[model samples]
Target: MSISSRSDKKGGFRRVRFIILAISVFYLAFLQSSVMTFNTAYVVLSNETSSPLFNQYQLGATAALLNMNQFDWSPTYLPLALHRFPLDGLQRSFTFAASFAGGLLGTFPMLYVLKHVGAHVTMSIVGIASCILCALTPVTIAASFELFVGFLAAPIFPVIGTVIEDWAPMEEKGLFVAILSAHVELDTLFTPPVGSLIAEKVNWPTVFYVQALVCAFFTVGWMYFYRDDPGEHFMITRDEVDMIHRGKTKDHLMSPPYRAIFTSLSIWAVFISAIGTIFVGQFMDVFSPQYFTSVLGYSPTITGTLTIIPTIALLPLKAIAGIASDKITRISELAKLRIFNSLACFLGAAFFVVIILVPPSTNSAAATALIMMPFILLAFLSGGFHKAAVMISRQHSSFVYSIVHIFSMLALICSTFTIPLLTPEETFEQWRIVFIIFIAVLTISNIFFIIFVKAEPAEWAHVSNTNEFVQLTEEPRPKHQLRQ
Candidate 1:
């Protein structure tokens, strides 16, 4: 039977164990984006004096130092340590940037840990630490815990790399990666509405506690449910394992090919592609709360409700894109990657441009419709670099995708710094500049991807045999494996 026929048959999902594994990843992803950014931004700006309308606090004093015009730099610019960062947006953004920097610095070491120690252990450590961090976040003004969490969470994509290589069937790689990565995003989708409701009906501090409990549950379950090797999974059947391993071999490299991977034009394409994707992602997930509240002038509940619309629309679209990429077997893997990658970037670029033109108005629904389109097009990425990262590098995928994670962290840091600085007033015109910057970055990124991306394994990685389950070893690049 053809690959398309098998894809139609629901290749990976037919197995029960893969279903459980996928669910675990979904919960793991849920922890990725904190609800505090969305639910707390409004509260931070609240004060009795300067902004009475936004003041939701019990205390008279604790209003944000960040104002309508620029950062209200108070006191002397001392190099001395302050116990608490100002309860202001600019300070908040700086700490957030620092956390991403922590992640950036921690990426390669975390990558090494995930490659050697196993994802199950790394994830469990994250879950445990996050529980402590989430609980303390409500009280601590210093973002030290968040920085540590960022370091641990830095391994997420590499973990996905492990999942893709371990369980995903060769032909069905796109489908497996798309669904799994989207599952990881399930948190970002639900956080807006759920976090909003929790903040409104209950309280914001409770949000942290709830997430802590979630962390505890995830930690225990992950330790029990996930395994470094699928064969170690007590519930997984031999037949399903065989199916996943079809046209794939299980081989471990003592060390990654650093020189080849870094030098390869394709890997650079993945890195560039990630920066583009992450710029949009950071904007949508982290900065959009500020956009909706400060620029669009929406309430916390309204902002959450509005954001969920685009996110809710993302899952099915991503699923469709993944399925389509798999079923369309007529196209080469490289062709499919280029087509789908271009589709994602171009579609997103178009939507972003539309949003800037329309701006926000009294017609809330229209404004929402305009804003949501760009975020919705994030689904098209399932067929884009997400899969390309795995296809191009194969077994070295964990290491390769770590490059994505590294660049993604840097993008987060840059966005944290740049977006806050750019939109000091948080006006629509200021935001238009930010969105336009993303459009240009995304377009240029796609051009690089089109030029350099390859779906086949790189010649240097040394596992080019087309036979089923052929083992790989470290060796020099071959003439056949060379990019044509």
Candidate 2:
């Protein structure tokens, strides 16, 4: 081919690759939302039905004896019964606990799979398996069985780090990581209302069926288009491959320095802060709907609607934070991360206090606004630490991410069990205690990150004179500048 022809082809291929990767990121976002939505809906349904089920039958005994489809299972059953069944907070908490525990159990195996098979394959498998598991949700006779299936689907979110490390350019790393991290908020933005509407209008089973179909579609697209490295992609031209590899010295495929990683205080800072952040977030995920309906006297639809405000506020704020972290070249990367991460947590803690001060009997709009402001502040503030994680361990970003994920999952599990224990009566007073605990956790974790987290690559991650490891200190030039 002529030089001009080759250049045109490479440009075209790069665009296609970019488009494919964008779609994949969004799909992963959707999947994350779907899982959370499924769990949220399950908790809502369990709360809605618990009293009626308990009133009518010995549910613990009946649950054991019944088959998957025996308990009046149908797409329409849940929607129709939403008004009929009464709320039970304890039951909801237990269901959340079970799902989180299942996720915790699934984390290690997911790490192993991601290491051996690579992210694209692992994610594709996870997508299909999650879809099947979601389809089985309505008929899940036992909570234990539901937990087991949830465990199977648990690896979806952590793998995004691998995808970003593989596809995103070094200069744009912060932006891409921020965008990918925002998937959680993106999921939050759409899933709650959509899931709630489906549960209310169509029925709960239909929700899972719909989610399954969406998952299958995306999974197929991902399997066909995603390549772990640019060189492996058939459509990628030589120029595009060179462009992708240009600033790179690191062998991203190398085995991680396990001891160095485990002993790193910076990693531990990220880990603990993630646990705190995720714990608070998961608490809201599982309980916020219940709180809206039970304590605040809002209907289910209104509760779902109210939650969207915080999610909407998060999107732009998160994008700004991500962009700022990338653009502020004067500051040390570690300093930038510390500032953003600590500020986000501290602000989030302040908002927790605001939430606690607002009486449950306060105007619903005011309450919603108070709850949302903190999330908005937090949305912009919290993701820099995640960007730092990638900076410190480019080759092992996924592995490092999995470690953070495990702690986050553990936090979710702890919240599931402890929230119920603290809020046994499900009163405003009980919830106040929960908020106080979150505030303390967030504050302490933020302090720890400020004190210990470093943005520089760990010493063990560096290549010796004899090796070909990528140098950590090299600044990545923009792609356009590089070719010029």
Candidate 3:
């Protein structure tokens, strides 16, 4: 065959590969939207268990100090008891310190397991272990230890992205990425309301039990259906596999160049922006109801019903922003995406800050109405900006997301603990300060993005040449320039 005919054949195969992967991704997306919510709601409910994973150690130590029985203490009792428990700083530090230490040590083992066993297998293991751990332990104790479980489970999404990249073609990359991220958005959006409903009728432990059953089902399904690569799956033809081999010159992904990747100002901006959204986002996840009850004086039922509105806004926003990004640039431009993301975050942050500044004595209905608008706005825009961030770094999605998420989550853990420490349990003022700081940091990140990021790949960049089946290292072009 002539060279041109061979090229045409390869292109045709690439298109076929893209379609198959897109179908798989959408299937996962639909499943994940339901499953992710169950998974997270279970974690939150587990936090109240006797041996909860993340906060269990802290609760255990405190219980030990107070000489209190886990069963006798209500959820309300523990917090009240802790307030009077004394040496507040030291106690809180121990909780955070132990969890952080465990996280650092646990990550190695987690990565090792994932690398050896693969994503589906490793996720199954963690899910099973966490469920058993929840069942055996008390609510308070379970809360403490669940943090470690969260850390261990962290790598699953990055692994999923890698699987998508290896098996999926260029045309479907954005949509697949959005599908994977949809798991996160759905988890955040739907889980809390579900948990609240459970908490209203039954005790919290049931949350984990239900979650455990669901995960067990998913584990079986995953093992049966999830092939790691296109080459392994029967649905992919040999012709398609060969084309993927040709198109992905950097076939086996390597560790990205840390220096160049990290030094990019856009990365810093993305990281800071993610953190900013996470602060407010955490409140929505963990404390929004507490805020509703304590600050706005709403009943749990009212809070539960109303709370879902912001997340409802987020779901469609995420889908629209992702589709828009894909439509605008066949290949993502970091500079353009960054600016758009920054603007969205900026608006979100501004609204959240305004809500925070309302005086402590504001009437409950008025406060709820005031904060609700900002909450919806921030949630929508935050979700939108986050999707764009993924698009812009399409080539390095897995590694970039992992690094950014690690830092963002660390900051998130710190913020979760700090807001309670700073504010009176019944007050909202301290949380306001958290939002202010979050907004300021993101604003600075946006400035860096505006000044330093470029619209195209850079000179020192590595380009995968579909036509040649090799990495093309060309002469240094102007900063942020891509070959035509």
Estimate, for each residue in 1-484, the C-alpha lDDT of model 2 and write its tens digit.
Answer: 1122222233445644466556666777766755565564664455434324434545565573463224452345444333222225665555556666777788878878887888778888877777777777666634575576557656655676776666666666777777777777776666666776777666656777777787778788888888776556657665555555444534556777788899998888888888888888765566777777777788976877776776777778777888788888898887898888876788889988988988858777787677666566776553567887887776678788877777877787778678878987788888899889989998998898888887776776553444332321244333543221
Over all chains combined, what TM-score does candidate 3 have?
Answer: 0.68
Winner on lDDT (2 vs 3) = 2
Clash count for each candidate, listed in order shown: 0, 2, 29
Write the residue-wise lDDT of candidate 1 on 1-484 in tens digits: 1121111111233475556556566656755754233234334223223333224332344333233224332325622111112356766665656567667777889887787788778877877877777777766545566677677667777778887887777767778777877854587655545565565566555666777786677678787878766544556544565567666654544477889888999988888988988887788777777888987788976786676677778888888998888889787888988888888787788888887888687566677677777778878888888888888788888888777877877786778778889999999999999989989988999999999998877776556354444221222234354222
Worst 10 residues of 1 by lDDT: 1-10
Model 3, 198-317: lDDT tens digits are 644664556545555554565555555555455554344445655454444342344456688777765565666666656656666566777888877778778876677666766666
Model 2 sits at a Cα RMSD from the real structure of 6.9
Q: Which residue pairs show collisions in model 1? A: none
**Model 3 misplaced stretches (Cα beyond 4 Å):** 1-105, 112-121, 131-148, 189-191, 195-204, 237-247, 329-335, 353-396, 425-432, 454-461, 464-484
Error of 2 at 203 (Å): 3.2
TM-score of each: 0.80, 0.80, 0.68
Residue 473, model 2: Cα distance from true site in angstroms: 21
lDDT to native, each model: 0.69, 0.69, 0.52
